[model samples]
Target: MKDLIKAINGHLAAEFQASHTYLAMSIWLRKKDLAGFSSYMLAKSNEERGHASRMIAYLVDSDETVELPT
Candidate 1:
């Protein structure tokens, strides 16, 4: 169970980082006036955040102490 929690946290951390990258790309695209691409990337970033939230919630509900990745 501890191992599972650790793995989940690790995955979430990676996902969160990915969200950051996506957001950056979105901002850049918006600056370039590519609204469509920017919106798509922004949506993808939101999805990643949602996934991280789900991972955290699952770990907490499973009675695991989830240490959010640094």
Candidate 2:
């Protein structure tokens, strides 16, 4: 269970990083006046955030220690 939690936390970190990267890309696109691309990237970033949330919720519900990644 501890190992599982650790793996899940690692995955969550990856998802968070992905979200951050997507957001940065979206902002850059918007600055370049590419509204469509920017919107798409923004949506992807939101989806990644949702994925991270679900992982955290699962950990909490499973009675596991939720150690947030740095």
Total clashing pairs for each candidate: 0, 0
lDDT, candidate 1, at 4: 73
lDDT of 1 at 56: 88
Tens-place lDDT digits, model 1, residues 1-70 = 6787788888988989989999999999999999999999999999999999999889888888777767
Best by TM-score: 2
Q: Stretches of candidate 1 above 4 Å error?
A: none
Error of 1 at 70 (Å): 3.0
Backbone clashes in candidate 2 total: 0
Score residue 27 of candidate 1 by CA lDDT.
100
Candidate 2 Cα deviation (angstroms), residue 64: 1.3
lDDT of 2 by residue, 1-70 (tens): 7788899988998999999999999999999999999999999999999999999999999988777767
| Candidate 2, position 22, lDDT | 100
